[model samples]
Target chain A: MTTLSAGKRLKSAVCSTEIMVIAAPDGDVEITCGGSPMGDGATNGGAVDPGHAEGTAIGKRYVNADGSLEVLCVKAGEGSLAADGDALAVKDAKKLPKTD
Target chain B: MLLEMAADAFGDRVAFVDPVADSSITYAELLAAARTAAQAVHDSGAERLAMLDVSNLAIPVGLFAAGWADVPYVPLNYRLTEAEIDALLERITPAYLVTDLTHMTAFGDRQGVALTSRGDFLGMARGGGGDEDYRSMDPEAVGVLLFTSGTTGAPKAAVLRHKHLVSYIFNSVEFGAADEHDAALVCVPPYHVAGIGAVLSSVYSGRRVVQLANFSPEAWIEIARTEKITTAFVVPTMLARIVHALEGQESAHMPHLQSLSYGGGKMPLAVIERAMQLFSDTDFTNAYGLTETSSTITVLGPDEHRAAAGSEDEAVRRRLQSAGVPLPGIEIEVRNDEGKALPTGERGEIYVRGDQVSGEYEGRGSTVGADGWFPTRDAGYLDEEGYLFLEGRADDVIVRGGENMSPGEIEDVLLEHGAVEDAAVVGVPSVEWGEAVVSAVVLKATATQTELQDWVKQHLRSSRVPERIEFWQELPYNETGKLLRRVVKERLDSA
Candidate 1:
């Protein structure tokens, strides 16, 4: 229910998950964690749903099916991420070599 | 946040080492120190945190402390003249200044400044007064401000936000990629972009950092052997010196060294080829980036380097000279002067778009266009396969003897001379230094080259003085009256 621009950090109202937007299409996009809408600086609310008990992994990126939405988990949470009612898939492991 | 992650993952692991001082800090100790030190920085009420010293424990502590304090961390060049450093310090007032013991007495005290020796600062960091809950999570907050000597005017602070640096780390580097035995030798000064990148990247990757405050070929090689170093990043000049130092040694192989990356200036093909032959098993990469991009945006990985070295095709062989493809989440394009994207293999200005790209300065808002692309101003062409070849660092920067100097900085000093009416400084290829500063001037009164050189030496660092100053009747300019520095450089190259 909020504008999701790139670089925006959002928190799940129902979980400890903190995600940073990697890419987003123009306008507002519905993003949820454990069936509850994620928000910027969202406070902890209802319990994590048993149906969404799948935990989010730290340092992994999640993307929507259409590829228009992407978010990276900076911190892990008990609830998994979803975009527009579709569960986001973990992007493939990065192939870029270590250049630092 | 980055440090917190590292501390959580492996608090017992060694995080940093100072070979010169024979000191080291573990991840847990570093986190504790940073948190405590951040309190002092916050209590000082400084708007920014500044460090004017070589790489040491203070470096990581100061950076993390600044992050915790929610202020921009500024690392200044120690090589600049006292007056030059003062000029820069004046710009960032109400600042917390950290310096090594050698510079303890250099500055007495300023009205809006808090100065502390590096040793004392570390004490403060480890003394146990910290805020356990302090954290700056706003991604848009400025993280680091590196002073870049511009092609015109005084050096301006290039801004890097928390997100820019974090994006680079998250995309290019996997968390906890380094094993406990992994160590990286860092020789570049703290002021360079590569140095900052080395610290942040190595820390995030869980590699122990072995820092050498002063770089000597013998010291660098000996430390690598002693520290059991596995990975490292060096600039072109440092690699060249090491290559020369290893000459004629039959048992010169560093088998433990896994990866060796070089950038910050053009790598002489001959130097790289010789090093490759010497260390046949080592992984060599070329990283191309600007301070504004928050470190590496493109990488010429080891595979590409080896492939180019062994390839017989002229184009494939030239890939060694090309900067490899853009990193994931980064996009690059070559465009004509009018900003139209050019086809592959056509020369044009380079522009990049990415979450990591922070094309901003302190006072200036941002150089990025409305479309999110930031013009690099570096002339280059993208090959058919998307390799980027840089014509030079920028059209104007003179990277000489491993130091980057602005032509305008030298030209300004030359113009201060009473005898000079107009001056144009350019870098021309040289045998020893990759590029040597040479200037052409139209004099209003009589002046000798030696006299002008001495004048520059008196005003600025000796390295900035042009090696050669030629008397010219007039300097070339385009129809729009922009000075054609490339023409001057071409004339000097021919001469």
Candidate 2:
């Protein structure tokens, strides 16, 4: 478990997955990959579990329900991601009308 | 760091396309090229990396490389005269200048400067000859040095730091928000603030960018259609020309164009209304900011455009003329000459405060106040609902016999006339009234000066009418679409 902040990058302890925080709520939140807590730096050394092997996709944002916390997948990995035991879903692409 | 984020997020996605070269690069390839370019900059012993070429793949490479190497990226105006270019080059000595073959020959032998052709720079970027790793740069370090378009006076280099740009992107754009098929058309020159902002924001949002070096109404429409460009930004003058180009057509004929944003000058109400009708499927945004404000501080968003265009309420419809409210994390206040915040609906100088508002010049440190507010030097007022209506630059305001008047106000009324194609209002010297409001007009159809004068008198007070009106073939405008009011004032004053 670590304190969450915007722009902080977290890497999977046992996979090639890396995620950067886009938005975060106050308080410590446990962010995990392959059922293991994510670390502060990139280190691709971990076993992938068959049950959690859906993997993260590059260029997609993963967010929790209620849309308070969001992380952008920086690298693809063979491990699914979760936050606080809840599986994060890929965020829906926003319509381009909001583009500046 | 912005490019790094994009590379990591969508390395396999195409980041940019160079149609003229018949080439494109994925985000990963662009990242690698930037790293290599950074190494070359380091090896060249240049304190700053300057690009004087037209828009191309190498511009982004040079921009990101400068950031990676912790040097200020300076993009010079390629349209300037040789003497003007040489004068600017002398200011940023010990610089690595990237240009085309023609300009390289013209400037390659200048002392204290290392010249690299655009082709050579692109080649070096793709060659990946350097082994040095990309270094993280400080957020406070100057990231870009943009020489302001000197509409009023000699150009000054407005400095933008990494923090300001990063904050702007973070606050405004969601990460990885764009669809894979989305591409943005960027036609503005690299030296313009919107050009830099567009490159950074589009890359960070994981969208492909299609750049047009030279702009023409026909070419822009053709390219936008062929490329299936989903989003685009244009200056007001560009939009006006485009509207004129599409005259008599049922629609813009661009089904894929989702959003169109215009800024960098006052957008005429007639032009925007016609644009909204023509590009019926497209969303329109009026983004207002300056070179010192890191692109957009206030945006009349798509929703507001739609609301104003479709509304029956007069107040709501008038928002189409306003610059809209401040963006997230940005605070705006209209202040009087004594620096006191003005009441709602009272016109005064617009002041802004935000993480993205740098307001710093190269030699003149920061102009931001201790309270963090930076007077924008623009005269405007906020509605009761906080929509900002810009009234031209404060210096451009006409003081006629102790009464203050905004040129934008007179110009807007002139533009509302059906016969007027374009109009510029400037303060000309007057022996009796201290200063007089003089107007230069470009008419679409024949209208007598008396008729146009009566049109303004009916819309506004008699004092707001121009003391003298001059008919012109066309009003003067800078390449980026800023009305050359100084030129107009000089001409009218001399006459």
lDDT on C-alpha atoms for all candidate structures: 0.84, 0.87
10 residues in a row with least lDDT, candidate 2 chain B: B129-138
Model 2 vs truth, CA RMSD? 3.6
Model 1 pairs in collision:
none
Top model number, lDDT: 2
* DockQ per candidate, 2 decimals: 0.47, 0.24
- For model 2, residues B65-115, the per-residue Cα lDDT tens digits are 999888999999988888888888998989999999484467878987999
* Distance from true location, Cα of B492 in model 1, Å: 6.4
Alpha carbon lDDT at A43, candidate 1: 65
Angstrom error of the Cα, residue B264, model 1: value is 0.6
Error (Å) of candidate 1 at residue B313 is 0.9
Error of 2 at A90 (Å): 10
